[model samples]
Target: MTEPAADSRTELSSLLHDLHLISSEKPLPPPPLPPITELLARLKEKLIGASSDSETSSLIGHVERLFQTADPDWLFSLTSVNEEGRQEELQAAYRSLVCALIGCADLPLCGDECSSLTPAAYQSVPIRAVPVCSALRALLGALGNWEETGLLWSVAPPVCVFAVTHFQDQVWTNPPSRAAARSLQEALLRAGGWRDSTHLLVGDGRQREEGEEGGKSRGILGGVLDVLQPQLTKDSWQRCEAVKLVFAWTLLQLARPSLSPHLPRLLPPPLLFNDHYRPENCMLGARCLHHIILNTPAADLRQFNRAEVVYEALFKHLYSTETTVIQLVLSCLLDLLLVLEKPPSSLDPSSGRRKPCRHDDLLRLVLIHMEAENKVALRRVYASVLPLLVDRMGVAVCRHLRRVERVVLGYLEVKDPPEETNRLKVLEVLQRMTRAAWPRMQRRRLHMLLRRLLQLMDDVSSDSQLDDLIRDKLMSQTTLCIKLLHDCSPGNAQTLLLQVDSSCCSPEVLGCLETVTMSTER
Candidate 1:
């Protein structure tokens, strides 16, 4: 842990020790809850005395012995007391007390001499404060301001994870406790609320981040992947089936760009096989991959030596039983295709295929989801994927362009007014074809496709009133065809242009097309 965090935890721990001492030692109150002013004053006095006190260790020992014995509710009640709406003081005090409780969880009593230590005895009565520690963090996390917050400061904060992991060790070593598991479940569930901010993954070296003030922002949980690995089921996939939800949630949190560098070690081996070998683990890994692709920059992805782990896993799961998994796979593949200039060799067939795999493989996988039931999302994937295939393989993908063209344009024919997303995708296919495939195609086929684009430009509704958005898209696409044809052969382009007629070719578009549709090849 960083020094500041250590210092914060130590101070909080000491303060809680005082609260324990004062409440238990002082003879007072019918129900003597110290008022806020007196409480703060007494705390200040102890903190000042603690600076020079030679008996500090003895005091800490007393608190540690009575850790579970004292009422956990004392600080909870005092910190939550309403003091005329002066919430800042309450929140400050609360933050310290909670951190200290988390510190208590961090305490180690593994020595053989410690007979009273909970783990040393298999059936010691449950520590009420121990299990509920996590729930307390969760409850307070839920009540805090998360809107403008980045991540769960409690989760992402420095020492808190160390404390929690220490608790996890005790839970693992002992006979199963329902109280601890239930508490952890609530904590993990609500713990997810803190990531309200959009985070960027820094893939360059992925080790640690440099702060603006030249400090490091590494969290306690960042380098602790080994501690989490067994729980991840990476080594033995079957053991943690009962705790998969908690495991999945924890792994996902750790997969954020900040924590993602450890993924190669943390994820299952031979990533492609995880889907069948362990479905829960595979899905969590896949979801984390989806988040990484969406949030991280493409240039930095190379730093992840095992990125193929993600693509390969997602690819195998393209036929997954779960719809959400397939959709996430498709989304991740789409991002990969769009962001990277070339397909990574992860898609290469081990049996020595004649050509490197391109977007076609991803497209084919996506095509499986095109049944009427899934057309909404997969259609968008299809639309986006087609252009990428054309751009990547050039004439190689167009060996049979007609079938592909039909599949894309088919979306436009479905409704009286076309879906804007699909129509734009059709235009994208046309745009890619004209840009990449035009030069190598047999002339007869090239001209045929060009004529089809002209027809789309002229496919005006019989009624005079047209949606402005559709008209603009239609005319812009026609301009692209005109540009492509002009670059191909101006006289031939003019012939197709004349067929557009004045009505669909509004003066603005016609003039724009006229200006650009000249033979520049000369």
Candidate 2:
């Protein structure tokens, strides 16, 4: 190869020199929240007024770095997806980025950039809006223009979902974040998030409804829906179960009159349902249904495209042979139980009565898991899941005490290694199960259940291969059960209390009792 002359300044040669300069900059500081507003204000100044393309471009790089700094999660995720450590960091950073982007868009910089940049840049018009308010939508409508950049267009739901979720965790108190979220939804909806299998269009890719005026969309939305509808079939973000679920979630947030028509195609279990018995399909469908159950308003459920089909899909997945799928299903079911919002009177004939809810169906579904053969079931999920059920639904779930007793008794049979861990998990669930009375159960049955609980406490075996930590956990769980019952039940708690003395209580249990008594006295 011949050496190039230095004076020519070939585009490729100049790019190489620029890369070296960028590589020499100081490492970005750890992204704390305090500096962001100021950082953005400076970024806004450079973006709006700078005539230098190079300066504008450098500031754009700062924007990306800001996202990386604000959310190490984006870096960790981009670097090592399977690593669990950065999930919290990613969530925090993501929330900050969402808020910051919205903040920047509201600045004069955004309007200036909008004008200076070619219309080609804002081609995917609506999804790229400032606040997605009626004003912005109308701005696009009046200008007859939109974004050329589909940059975040396709994956907007998952991004919107994560932002809204973190905002919810923050208690939805940030008005800018909330406005930004609504703006994003309008943008995405304009991008066509609510289509399903039945939405048809002419091959030239225009809506068949000819007379509706510019309703003859180049059908950009129809294409976006097509991409999202069987999203996973194509792989990457489109195929991700989380992305699929959040898409449904974003739609639920918008249940507007124009938007509700799009729900059937984008949601509805049957449209997305394939050979759901496959673990990947089952997990994807279960996850999507989970968010659907969560995001759909209680008032809109019945009207939201065969929601019964969705619930039935959930019911089937609860019995999934795959424990991972079942665990995921359990989480969705638990959410449904918690958020089982009833329809308002005008929306239902029940007129504020406790209309038939999927929660009742969920309770029956949980009992089926309990009723499954103990040796066949995954005790790990069962143990953790049942307690959450009883805790959330309270006495209504306690009605199934016989099922609980049967499950506990079935687990207590074997001291073998195969059964040891299962025993520990069941003991934890059982302790939580006994925190309140089963008003419907016979006192004899309660006695039997309580007796089993005591027997579990007393059956310590040093000969077992169980390590000290495992044994301690078992003992601690057993002690807490007694404490919970002691606190929550009346006569039953009193009856159980008589069974424990210095002899029955392990040192940990004794210590726990002392703490309780001391606190009570104070």
Candidate 3:
């Protein structure tokens, strides 16, 4: 490299001084930058020999200003480098700038700081939040142009990994800082940085073993998990929410098979959240667990009794009174249950001696809860999950016929307003149960269920609050449930309908029953 004249050095120092004094209230517009190329070259030269923190901070401020005020294309241009050494120079410059920017942003850039769980490790010093946030915004602005220039490819991995691990509560919770961090993340992924980033964050087996030897060698994702796992405990998860949210956002972007190998590390945090006492955290945990269960291969989940652990965590949430929490837990458990045991195929032989497994236990619990459930939202959730559970249980639903019949009858007797969501779902459950346990659906069960369907039709017709659409929906679903019951028992519903006097029943109820019997015969 040629020695720079004193004027070049003076100009660079003047630029840095000016940038240091710029007001933070508004963005500085791009200045005339024909000298920026020479200034950047001079800046790089100074950065190589820069030793003091003060010198580095000053240089980082100048870089942040250039990022914000300069055209990205002109700012990142490498036209001056010879072709033979272009790649090396480009990489060195990119690294120096990124490291400086990350440092100025007060984020963890090196392995040791990244891996540390202590709060002090994340906070380097008492730096101004605005300046740090501004540095991050500048970095994000530069990164946002990566797709157009493609010069950022080499440094994308570290920058992305740094953002994911360090952009937590402080950066993300602030409105402006959050926008910058989010934009940086989108740019990274959009520029095809996720591949390299994933490799760096989620290393292969050898890299993982190396990571285990010294925490310093761990990939950013693993290192983050180390810090995150301990904080995900019952009493501590609230404090860790910011990091957990970022972690999940990253984890969800990764698909199956790729995510499978890391399940053991990835599984615990969500389980802890799911097991938390707070509804919001518990819902978040269930959603995370649900994502993991869906993406992971069933064999991996079953390995080391992982599925059972997840099941136990989620099963307890079934008892939660928060309807939203219970809704998420039910969704998570349904998928998790499949990992523990496969649902029976239609061709599989029925065995009366088969042991009652998790499915049976879950169904029994849901039915027990359903029978006593009065809150409309809880009733809606339980009713919605029941059909899927019944379908999964297949012929084994015969085992819970008494409770199932009671639940069906009880739900039918009540009115779920507006759309009658609970009643509609309960009718679907009846249809699935009828199909699954047809042999058990004999005359007595058929009669009890049939009577409820007729009365539901009557009640729905009488309720002036229900609009034409909702009333029609209830009548149609109840009619279907009756038809399924008739098919299972064959002729019992017809006999019961015949015995009903027209004087006691409304024309609408009697008309709906006539439609079912007619449909069954045809």
The top-ranked prediction according to lDDT is 3
Residue-wise C-alpha lDDT for candidate 2, range 403-480, written one tens digit per residue: 767877767554536446667767766665565443454566656655665666556533356676766777676666
The residue pairs that clash in candidate 1, if any, are none
How well is each residue in 169-194 modelled by candidate 1, as lDDT tens digits?
A: 34333334444544453443344432
Q: TM-score winner among the candidates?
A: 3
What tens digits encode model 3's per-residue C-alpha lDDT throughout 1-522? Answer: 232344443443457555443233433332234434345455656655567767766766776666665554445554555478764666566656555555444434223311324555445432423344455456555765453333454455446644564445553234445455556656555444344445545544235342233222233555445545664555555553355675676577656667886787788778766766667778878888888989889889898998888888888878779999999888888888777876743333555454667888999999999998888888899999998998898888888989998998888778787788888888888988888788888777788888787778878888888989988888888888877877776667678878878888788888888887787778
Candidate 1 whole-model C-alpha lDDT, 0 to 1? 0.47
Per-candidate alpha-carbon RMSD to the true structure: 15.0, 19.7, 9.3
Ten contiguous residues minimizing lDDT sum, candidate 3: 210-219
Residue 450 lDDT in model 2?
58
Better of 2 and 3 by lDDT: 3
lDDT at position 459, candidate 3: 81
**How well does candidate 2 score on lDDT at residue 403?**
72
What stretches of model 2 exceed 4 Å from their correct place?
1-222, 227-262, 268-271, 337-358, 375-377, 412-432, 438-442, 461-464, 484-522
Steric overlap count per candidate: 0, 15, 0
